[model samples]
Target: MEENQINELVHSFITYDYNNLSINTEELDDGKFFSIATIEKNLGKQIFTPNFEAEFKLIKAISHPEIKKI
Candidate 1:
């Protein structure tokens, strides 16, 4: 994040233990005001795959042109 620019952070997980993995903050080219992360789920031993596509999609859908407190 840049100076004086508050970045909206994002991370997703299946549980508080974080058995599923959380994504790192990646600034998307779509806009500077928004960011993205890809969460991974553990299906089985040593198996990891994308898990929060729907949630991320909803986030993307709800992104605002300007920030607001609620």
Candidate 2:
């Protein structure tokens, strides 16, 4: 995918919280990329999971088997 598309996906993932948050990305020499984000909450400490809704949407978009060219 294009760089801009990748950036947009990353932005959507990070902003899923809808709160004041920040995400940072790091690229390793091996060409792998990872992201870290800080989420501010008012409640006590709790286990949190990364939101993958946007990613799932992307996957579903590309997984359609009818649109094929051979």
Candidate 3:
């Protein structure tokens, strides 16, 4: 995949998790922002693999300015 596409995917997962936790940007630490270590620690060895729907959702979400900030 392209670099931008990959970045969007990662961002989407981060946003999803953050929203689930009801966390705002100010409350998020550096470790929680696109850190592989944090993802592995929180998700427990389950690496993120985007399926078709997830890919679509990520693409859509990342394109939106509001969602991208989260």
For candidate 3, write residues 1-70 as lDDT tens digits: 7666654223444353544554476855532344434443444333544443355355646565654443
Ranking of models by TM-score: 1, 2, 3
State the displacement of the C-alpha of residue 48, model 1, in Å, after optimal TM-score superposition.
7.9
- The candidate 2 region of ten consecutive residues with least summed lDDT is 30-39
- TM-score quality measure for candidate 1: 0.24
Estimate the TM-score of every prediction: 0.24, 0.21, 0.21
Give the range of the ten consecutive residues with the poorest summed lDDT in model 1: 31-40
Task: Return the clash pairs for model 3, or none.
Answer: none
Task: Predict model 1's lDDT versus the native.
Answer: 0.37
lDDT of 3: 0.46
Give the runs in model 3 whose Cα sits over 4 Å from its true position. 1-48, 52-62
The full ranking of all candidates by lDDT, starting with the best, is: 3, 1, 2
**lDDT assessment of candidate 2:** 0.33
